[model samples]
Target: MIDEHRQDLAAEYALDALDPESARAFEAMLANDAELKALADDLRETAAALALDAPAHLPPPELRERILSRIRAEAEAGAPAAPTATAVAPSTEAPVPSGGGRNLLPWALAAGFAITTAALWMERGSLQQDRTALLQEARELRNRDFLAKVKIATLSAQVDAYSKATAVIVWDAEKQHGVVKLNNVPPAGAGKDYQLWVIDPKYPAPVNGGLVPVNAEGIARVSFSPDQPISKADKFAISLEPAGGVPKATGPIVLLGGN
Candidate 1:
């Protein structure tokens, strides 16, 4: 039987905070069970409530200004600007002549060599800093791509698992962007319906994305903008409830995905 613990797990999955192995285990169970499906719906509803009630966090004004300035500079330059921080230059040390030949050329060569070494050191430091920044940017891009693929795969799996109808939801991790696609879902009864939920991992609860209806083809797609990145969520789900959803899970889950 699906219990409150499962409901909680489903909620956590929607938020994207579940450890990898646990999420996979939950998905495995979700694949074959109807009761869990209902629980998933309830969790989704709870998530919707959390999304609506949660407070929003805005970036610091100074940080925003800095970002805007950087963007403007890039636009003016028609190219990307160098990173703000760079590596420190290496220290220079005079080298002694090979074989202790006290020759006039040795001292002259040493001075020239020291100057060249200093220049190279400075250049190396700048290059190192640039490399570090580039690496960080690359990592961020990769993470975003990974989350996108995960969302697509999770939705596809949910659709495949349902013997009845199913829906796919999408959200942007950074901007609270969102959309939904439905398949094979039947229309709800009068005074009964399905509602969407967007769960944030950082928050203690879920949030409402919107409501959706099953169509003639048993498919529906809804688009929305969330308050934050969907990728940071534990999971997304749908639920059958009264015409409107409740603040917490009060019914069974319709769909869910996480990790």
Candidate 2:
């Protein structure tokens, strides 16, 4: 029988924050548990619909002031913090990366937050339309935060290195995932592919970043999310390589720029 602790994981699971072993355990349980599966599916659906919600509502006034006051009161009282959460019982699976896998728990939690918020406002004497307006505001806040967490870096063509080019890269350093947009690049013909490289103080050698296929319109766009973490990009460079990328840089460099 799954306990409340396990139930609480529904939100984390939906957010893909479950530990690997825990994730596997949850997945196994999910496969055999009809109710759990339904719950996960519902979360996924709600999260997907967040974008369609109405405009965001402004947060309650004085919320910040009240929070700060609490903090001050805690300091004055010299409150001792509770110990960190205890270790979870041993799990059946191995640990996995934070960003890995797709779990619907987070969406469920988001939906719950929105629904509960609306219910609260209604109980506080808000009308149906007002509650809906509140939900939209909450959606907008979540969407903004989600977007802000994603890191993006842009690079322009290095002088004397490329005829004409510009690039935009969106990367999640923690997740080691990113997409590269090499715009106005020279056409890469058959048997040739464009390779990207990462330069960071952490790695003496440049990381063998992913490759991009150039389109007829002179653009190469590719998305990558490596399992291993990549340091802050000191420099992003592009080079020509064979259909399959090489382990090291060997061909002529096409474009280069620093972060």
lDDT, candidate 1, at 150: 29
Per-residue lDDT of candidate 1, residues 1-259 (tens digit): 3444665566556655468899899888888987576546544543343344335443344654454455445545763455587896665876656453565478658755754565456456555666688667654654455345324313322433354554445444554655566666766678876777777777666666666766777666666665334546677877767776565655556677543
Q: Give all TM-scores, in the order shown.
A: 0.39, 0.43
> What lDDT does each candidate get?
0.58, 0.61
Q: What TM-score quantifies how close candidate 1 is to the native fold?
A: 0.39
Model 1, stretches more than 4 Å misplaced? 1-150, 153-162, 227-231
| Top TM-score model | 2
lDDT value, candidate 1, whole model? 0.58
**Per-residue alpha-carbon lDDT of candidate 2 for residues 35-152, written as tens digits (9 for 90 to 100):** 5565455444333333233255555666545545554565548645555878888878997645423444785576557555654554454344556887676555544554444443
Q: What are the C-alpha RMSDs, in order, of all predicted structures?
A: 16.9, 26.2
Q: What clash pairs does model 2 have? A: 14-104, 14-105, 14-106, 15-106, 20-96, 43-108, 56-137, 57-137
